[model samples]
Target: MESQESHRIVVTLAQKARDGADAQQLADFIVSSWQTIEASLSPIIGQRSVATLYKRSFYLASREHPWLMDMHEGMQTTVNLAALKAALLERTSAEIAAGAGAALQMFYEALTNLIGASLTERLMRSVWADLFPVPTQENSA
Candidate 1:
């Protein structure tokens, strides 16, 4: 199903963000990715809706990784990127990957449910073009 594909995209993006990242770099990448996603989605869904989805996703992810709640405490109309980045810096790579990936997957599922999978895919693909790279053709000798 398209929703499944959308989830894959979210997972792939998270993996890409985590790849080759040190703790500081990983936190920067995670926070930057969220900011990019928020910028892309907010106009279409409204900032408040995006914020709600973010909060919901973070809350759901925090059930599995309670440290995530620290980032949620001071959030308002949007995620506190600084808080999230700080929290991420304190986590191991595996925890960062799992928690960030889970939150993103939840957000994608919720977004797809709200906007339909087709639009969500289009929007996300545009926002994260690097994740769905076009393969280059190879010439045989």
Candidate 2:
């Protein structure tokens, strides 16, 4: 079992990892760290709900725009986990910010590919659309 603080740090690092690190590196980190996040949230949310929330968040985050699309383009890149862990430990906010967008794109791509497009699309549509409500035909018509 992982500590909550460690999980939070991992989540933050995973978010940063998406900024500029290699897609595979970020993907691997997400995969490993997911257990921590899941564990941390499990008691509060229940396993199924926590899993669903994670899927939704990842889907929505990944599909926000073209950067993520580009990230998906290189989804097969293998991550050097040691290097990634080091980068997460040492990388600055500016550096992270610079590559974070692209990393997130890649993360989304990897996730969508692993999880399937339909599920990813449904998660994105349900979670993100609620936050940033797309105008419906009723509104336009």
Question: What is the TM-score of candidate 1?
Answer: 0.78
Reference-based lDDT, residue 23, model 2: 46
Per-residue CA lDDT of model 1 for 1-141, tens digit only, reads: 335554554455455554656667666767877898888888888888888889888887799889887655656787677778878888887678778877777787878788887787788886656533332233111
Query: Tens digit of lDDT per residue, candidate 2, span 1-141?
Result: 232222233345444444466544544544454444445445654665554444343335445432322322322223233443444444444343334433433434544665666664554443333322343454323
Number of the top-ranking candidate, with TM-score as the measure: 1
Q: What is the lDDT of residue 33 in candidate 1?
A: 76
Q: Which residue pairs in candidate 1 collide? A: none
**Error in Å for residue 60 of model 2:** 2.0
Worst 10-residue lDDT window, candidate 1? 132-141
- lDDT (Cα) of model 2: 0.42
